[model samples]
Target: MGPLIPQEIISLDWNLVIAFVVGIGFGFVLEASGFSSSRKLAGIFYGYDTVVLKVFFTAAITAMLGLLYLSLFGWIDLNLVYVNPTYLWSAIIGGIIMGLGFIIGGFCPGTSVCAAAIGKIDAMVFIIGIIIGIFIFGEGFPIWKEFHEAGNLGSLKIQDIIGISGGLFTFLIIIFAMILFKTGEWAESQFTREEY
Candidate 1:
């Protein structure tokens, strides 16, 4: 009834087709959201623009609510979903490194692809940097293997850890996002500029 791939009700070809369609939708949305511009993307960090944060948090909350309700109605099997295994310290370390990359390069792996598609030179460089980072990770995988496999907290949901009602948690996250959205809107006004 859920996770068409894991359950094997759908063929691999169907999966690929779905993936392609989803990728196109994703790309279209990113471009329409102005994510193709590195300056627009970078503004989230500098307080000049915060479309990035607003879109990110809004998407997160939307998905969070959808999953919560889907599970509640037994429309989806939450356990069948992919859960990123926690690697303890590596999450913090990797997140910090990614944050630095985003701040400096102004793109993550996905958005960088869109930016490069739209003829952004800096995004092209960022894509190259990501490739290099992946190459480095592959070469050094042996060294990081221990940390990568460490603290194996298997497939967990937020409710599993916090012992709260899923609906309550989703509501709280939405409230938090509303606060951030307000702040982001304020910063956009306060930090508006008349010159490039």
Candidate 2:
């Protein structure tokens, strides 16, 4: 009825197996969708290709709405769902670092893995960097542990905080997406090159 593991409908082994299956599906989709190319991804910023924007925003808003609907239907209790706990300063600083990494490295952990699977040398290097970064984080967790634990707005709901119904909020999101989609289409026509 809810998240299977939390509801005890699925055992941990079943949960892990499902996660692996989902990951495989996700990776296959991304690779097939051309997300495996860093150039293809960075095009979101430049506007030559809107595949990244289209896919990302579509996935995000769809999931957002789906969760809202699930909560409304009493299928998934919103209160029981895990929200990413906030670490305010860490979020800001980490976001900046992550943005820089995205700009320079051109692949995030997911996309890098996707590209790596499809045999891209750059993506393979990016995955190696991610592994090294993970190792460093494990080694240095004590140093930033305090900051990471700082701003715990535990499982906060944006809808509750903003005092707006999720339906209305989703409407606003759809409007914004329509505008962005139009602009992206315009830019793609304007900026597309023969080379790419």
lDDT (CA) per prediction: 0.87, 0.84
Best by TM-score: 1
| Residue-by-residue lDDT tens digits, candidate 2, 1-196 | 8866777887767877898999999999998887888988888778888888888899989998998888888898766666787667788988988877776888878999888887889998888888898899889999989988888777666767899987898888889998999999999999996655
lDDT of 1 by residue, 1-196 (tens): 7677887888767988999999999999999988888788888888989889999898999899888788888878977888887777788898999999988988888899999998988899998899999999999999999987887777667776899977888898899999999999999899995642
**Which pairs of residues have clashing backbones in candidate 2?**
none
TM-scores of the candidates in the order shown: 0.92, 0.90
In terms of lDDT, model 1 sits at 0.87
Question: What C-alpha lDDT does candidate 2 achieve relative to the native structure?
Answer: 0.84
Candidate 2 regions with alpha-carbon error over 4 angstroms: none
Give the winner by lDDT. 1
